[model samples]
Target: IPQFEDVKFEAASLLSELYCQENSVDTAKPLLRKAIQISQQTPYWHCRLLFQLAQLHTLEKDLVSACDLLGVGAEYARVVGSEYTRALFLLSKGMLLLMERKLQEVHPLLTLCGQIVENWQGNPIQKESLRVFFLVLQVTHYLDAGQVKSVKPCLKQLQQCIQTISTLHDDEILPSNPADLFHWLPKEHMCVLVYLVTVMHSMQAGYLEKAQKYTDKALMQLEKLKMLDCSPILSSFQVILLEHIIMCRLVTGHKATALQEISQVCQLCQQSPRLFSNHAAQLHTLLGLYCISVNCMDNAEAQFTTALRLTTHQELWAFIVTNLASVYIREGNRHQELYSLLERINPDHNFPVSSHCLRAAAFYIRGLFSFFQGRYNEAKRFLRETLKMSNAEDLNRLTACSLVLLGHIFYVLGNHRESNNMVVPAMQLASKIPDMSVQLWSSALLRDLNKACGNAMDAHEAAQMHQNFSQQLLQDHIEACSLPEHNLITWTDGPPPVQFQAQNGPTTSLASLL
Candidate 1:
C-alpha cells in the first residue's frame, strides 16, 4: 500500500510538471488537487501537495484560492502539531494578503506568527528561519505603509536573524519533525533578501547613496547565484532590484541609464510568461515615469492608463492615479478625468492608500492642481499639508517639490520675501536630492524673485544656475529620446514589443548612476 501511494504521488507530480512545462497550468491544477486529496493519509506529502497546488493557483493570479489553500494548510499543520510549518503556511498567506493590500488581515496574522516563532521550542535553524520570515513580513508591512522610522527595529532583527542562520550549520542536526525538514530559504538566498529589504528601506528614507551601495552588493550576490541556479525567484529579485535602481537613476538625472535598464527589465520578464504577467503593470508604470521625465505628456498618460488597467493592486493603483492626475494637471486639459481621479485618491475621503508618502504625494498633486487653476490660497493650504506630512516621514523629494511649488506660488503673488524664504531652502534640499527638475524650478523662482526684489547680482547667479540645469536636462532628454528602446512608450496592449524580446537575460553589472 505504501509503495502504491509513493508511485501515485510521483506520477501525479511528474505529470503536473509536464503539463506546467507545456503551459497547461489548468490541467496541472486538477492533477495536483487530486493528488492532494489522496495524500491525506501521509501528513508530510499532504502538506507538500497543498503547497504545490497553492503555488499553481498563485501563478495563475487566483490569489483567493491560493490564500484559502494556504489557510487550510496552516490548519492542517496545526492539527498535526507542527507549529513550525504552521507558521510557514500562515506567513505565506500573510504575504499574499499584503500583496492584495489587505493590511487589516495581515496585521493580526503576522502578530500570531511572531508569537509562535518566539514561543516554539523547535530546532534552532527552523526557529531562526521562522523568525526571519516573520520579521521580513513586519518590515515589508511597515515599508509599504511608508513608515521608514517604524521599520528600523524589525529590519535590524531581520538582519541579525539572517546572520544567526548563516552561522548555523544546516546539517548540524536534522530537524526532528518531518514538517520542519524544509527551509524557507537557504542562507545565501536569505542574505540577498535581507540586502534587498535594506535597500528598500534606505530608498524610502531618502538615503539614496546607501540604497545604491546595498543594491550593488545585493545584485552582485544575485548574479553569482544565477550562475549556479536559474530559479524564477532569483529573476524576480533581479527585476525588483532593477526597478528600484531605475527609479533612482531617474531621480539623480540619469535618464539614459534608466531607459536602458527599463529595456533590461522587459527582456528579463520576457523569458517567462508568468514573470511578464506579474510585472507588466510595474513595467508600464516605470515607462510612464520615464515618459514624464522626458516631457512626453501624451505617452506618459497612455502608459499610466495601461498600468492602471493592468493592475488591481490598491497601492499601485493609487500611485498611478496620482501620477496620471499630475500629467493631466500639467497639460491643463482633461479636467473631468483629473477631478475623478483626484476624488478617488483623496486622503480625506475613504483614501485607499496607507503609505504616508503616497498620501503626501496626493496632497502635492492637489496643491499643484489648485496652483494651476490660480487658486493660490487653496494651493498653499494643500502644499503646507504635504510639507508637514513629508517632513514628518523624511520624504525628501516630496518635501523639496512642495517647497519649490510653494515658492512659485509666492512669486506669482509678488511676495518676493516669502518666495525667497521658500525657494532658498527648496534649492538647497533639491541640490541634496539632486532632483534636477526641482532644482531647475527652484533656481528659476530664485532668479525671478531676486530680480523683482532688485537684487541684480543674486538674480544673475540664479540665472546662470538655471541655465546650467536647463542644458543638462535638455542633453539627457535628447539622449534618452534617441534610444532604440524609446519606442516602448507606444506599447500599451498585448504582449511586449517583439523587438525587445531576447533569447537571454541582460548582463547584471548595473553600476550606480548616482
Candidate 2:
C-alpha cells in the first residue's frame, strides 16, 4: 500500500509463482487477484495477470471462466499494443481445445500461431520453443485422428525446431512462472510435449518396437526435467509414459507383465493424484481389455464403466462404448443395451480419414454382437465392412481380431471352405508382425480350421505351435512389464527367433524395453 504500482505488482507476481511451484494454488490465487487489481491501472500487467488468472481457472476445471478470461486477455493484448501477446493468447486457447480433442476449432488458431511465430523478433529461444510446441500440437492432431502419414512432415519439422532451440544462448533466461510469462511455453515443457507426442505417434503408427524404444527415451527425459519437484506437468507425463509402456507390453502379449506395470502405475497415481487426476480413463480401459481376454466379464464391465466416466475425448469414449457393448453381448444382453449402443454411434467421418478407425471399430463390434446373437448374414455384412473401411496401422490388430471372429461365424454356419479361407489370410497377417501377440487368437482358429477340413496331421502341428506361442508369451511378461535398467532400446526388422522349450527365454529386441 505504501509502494508504487510497479513495485507492488512485481512483488505480488513473484509470490504467486512461488506459491504455484509449491502446489499451493489457493495462496497463489489471492495474490494474483491482488496483483491484477493493483495493475489494473497499467494495460500490460493487467492483461498478463488476467491470463494468469485464467490458467488458475483451467486448473480448477472451470473451462467457461477460462474461455471468458481468454476473451478478456485478447482485449488487453490490444490495449498493450502487442501482436505477439495476442498471437500467444490464441495459441494458448488452441492448446486448451487441443487437449480436449476439439480438432475442428484448433486449426484456425494454429494457422495464425504459425504465422505469428514466423514473424516474431523476440529472443531466439522463446520463438523457437513456440514453433516446436506448435509442431507437436499439429503432430498430436493428426496422430489421434489416425492419419500417420500426415504426421511425417510435422515430425521432420519438430526435429528441426528442437535443433534450433538447442542452438540458442544458454546464459540467457526466460520466464519460468506462468503469472509473469503468460505468452509462451517453456523450453523444457516444450521438449516434454514433443517427446510424448512422438512416442504416441510411434505406437499408433504400428511400430511396437519403436514405441517401446521411444517410451524409454521419454521416461528418461521426464526424470531429467529441470522443473519443480514432482511438478504436476511432470507427473502428468509420468502417467502417460506408464500408460504407453503398458500398451506396448499388452500389444506384444505380456498380460502378466502388463498387469504388473498397471499395478505399479496405479500405486504411483494414488501416491500422486495431482499428475494423474485425468488419467484413469486409459488405465481402466486397459484393465477392461485384459479382463475381457481372460473371460472376466463382470470385472470387465465395471472397469469399462469407470473408464467411460473418466473419458473426455469422443473417440476414446466411443471405443469404451463399443467394448461395453461387447461385454453386454457376451452376457446374452437380456437388457437390449447392445443394440441401443450400436444404434447410438454414428459411423460417418467429417474430417481427417484417421477417424476411420472408430467407424471401423463400430463395424467390427457390431459384427461380433451379430455373431453372438446368431444373426449370421448381418454378422457377415458388418465384418466385411470393417475389413474394407477401417484404415490405420493401430487398428490392424482389431481388424485381425474381427477376421478370426468372421471365420468362426463361417464354421458355426457349416461353411467350412469359407472358414478355412478367412483364417488363412488372418493368420498370415498376424504372423507377419515381429510380435505374435496380434495373432494369438489366430493360432487356435487355424488349428480348428485344419481339424474341420480333415487335415489331422496339420491340425496336430498347429496345436503344438499354438501351445508353444502361448507359453513363450507368459514367460516374457515379467521383463516386458518392468522398467529398463539401461538407456538403449534395441530393434530388428522381422519376427523374432522362436524357442520351443521353456528352458530358453524370449530373444527379440522387442522383449527388452532398455
Candidate 3:
C-alpha cells in the first residue's frame, strides 16, 4: 500500500493536471476529495486541496462557492505558516473581487501578498512561476484602475521574463524527463503567457493595432500545437482571444474579415452543437452586426434572433439588444420595446467597460436609433458626446456614423455649412479605413446634403463615390454567397422566403423583441 503522506501529496498535485487537461470537474472532484480526506491531519495539505477546489469553482463562475472555499483555505494557510500558498490564495481572492468590480476590497489583500513575496526573496525555482503569476494579477489590477503609468514597471518585468526564457536553448529550458519535476509541460505555455503580457501592455497604451499583431502571433503558435481540444485551460484562453480579436476587428472596421472569421467559428460550433451552443450565439450576434452594416435587414433580424436564442448572458445580450433597437427604428416601427431593452442594458448604473471609446460608440449607436425616430435634438446630444471623445485611430465606424448623424441634425436645423464640414471629415476617415458599408452610407448622405445646398460639383462627386463603393460591396457579397450551404448566408437582396431555418423551435421574432 502507498504511504498516506506520499499518496495525498501526489493526488493534490495531479488534480491540477487533470483539471487542466480533460477539464472534467467531476473526474477531478474525486481526486480532490480524496486528497482533502487524507490531509485532514495536516493543515498545510488541507489548505492546498481546498484552494484547488476553490479555483475549480472560480473557473465555473461560481463566485459564492469560490469565496467560501477561499475563506476556509486562508485560515488553514495562516495556521500552517505556508506563506507561499497563502500569498497565492490572497492574490486569487483579490482577482476574484476585482472581476466583480469590488476594487476597494482588493487593495489590502494584494498588498499582503506582495509583501509576502517580497520578504521571501530567495531565488528558488518555484519562486519564478509564483512571481510571474502574482505580477500578472498586479498588472491587471492596474489596468482595471486605468492607471497606465503605474503598470509600466510590471510590464517591463514581464517582458524581461520573456526575454530570459527566449535566451535559454529550447531543450535545456524545459523539463526533459516525464518523471522529472514539472515534466510534460508544453513550452508554448510560456509563449502564451508572454503573449498575454504583451497584449495587456498594448491595451494599456491604447494600441489596438499593436495588440492585434501580438495576439495574431500567439494564435498562430496555438494552432500549431496538437494538444487535446477538450482541455478547459485551452478552451478558456481560446475564448478570451477570440473575443478580443472580434472586438479589435469591429473597432477597426475590418467588417468583412471579422465576418469571415466569425463564420468559421460558427462552423466549428455546429460540429459539436451541444458543447458550443453559447459560443455559436456569440458568433451569430456578431454576424448580425455585419449584416446590419451591409443593409441586409432581413438577414440581420434573423441573426439577432439566433443570438437571443443562444444564451441569457446580460452583457452579451446588450450588444444585440441595442442593435435590434436600431433596426426597429430603421423600419419605422413603434420602438418603445426597443427603448425598454436599451434601458435594461444599462439600468441604474454606469457601464461596466469604463472605456471612453466603447462608451462613445454606444452613445453614437443610440444617436442612430434616435435619428431614425426623427428625434433630432436628442440625436445631436448623443452624437456630439461621441465626437467629444473621438481621436485618431479609434473606431472609424462610430466616428463616421456620428458625422453622418451630425449632417442630418444640421440639415434639420437648416445649417448646411456645419453639416457639410462634419460629413467631409467622415468621408476622409472612411476612405482611409476602407469600410465599404460606412463609405457607402457616408457618401449617400453627402450626395443628398450637396444637392440640398445646390453644390452641383460636390453632388456629382459624392454620387460617383456612393455608386462605386456600393456596387463593389454588392459584387463581393454576391461572390461570397456562391458557396456551400453550410457557409454563412451572404448580404444579397429581397427573397420571398427566408432560406436558413433555425433548428431550435419558437425563436422570438427579433422584430417583436426590439
Residue 337 lDDT (model 2): 72
Off by over 4 Å in 2: 1-6, 14-34, 37-44, 78-81, 99-104, 167-186, 226-229, 310-313, 333-335, 346-355, 392-394, 410-425, 432-437, 450-461, 473-514
lDDT of 3 by residue, 219-254 (tens): 776676525445444444555566556555654555
- Model 3 TM-score, 2 decimals: 0.72
> What is each predicted model's overall lDDT from 0 to 1?
0.87, 0.69, 0.64
CA RMSD of each candidate after superposition: 4.0, 8.6, 8.0
Query: Model 2, 1-514: lDDT tens per residue?
Result: 6547767677777888788879898999888887777676665577767787888889887776776777667656656566556666777777688766666778877897888779877666667777876787787777667666567888889978886786777544553333224436556667666777777776665566777777787778777873445556777777787787777676677666666566556656665655455666776787777666555677788778877777676777887888888888888944577667777674543421246666777878878877877999998898888877634334556566677888888888888888878777777766643346546667787788789889999899889888988888756644433433100112011121121122254533233556
- Residue 12, candidate 3: Cα error in Å is 7.4
Task: Report the error of model 3 at residue 240, Å.
Answer: 3.7
Model 1, range 290-372, lDDT digits (tens) per residue? 99999999999999999999998777898899999999999997999988989998976777878898898899999999999
Model 2: worst 10 consecutive residues (lDDT sum): 485-494
Determine the backbone clash count of candidate 2: 3
Model 2 lDDT, full chain set:
0.69
Per-model TM-score on C-alpha atoms: 0.92, 0.78, 0.72
- How would you order the candidates by TM-score, starting with the best? 1, 2, 3
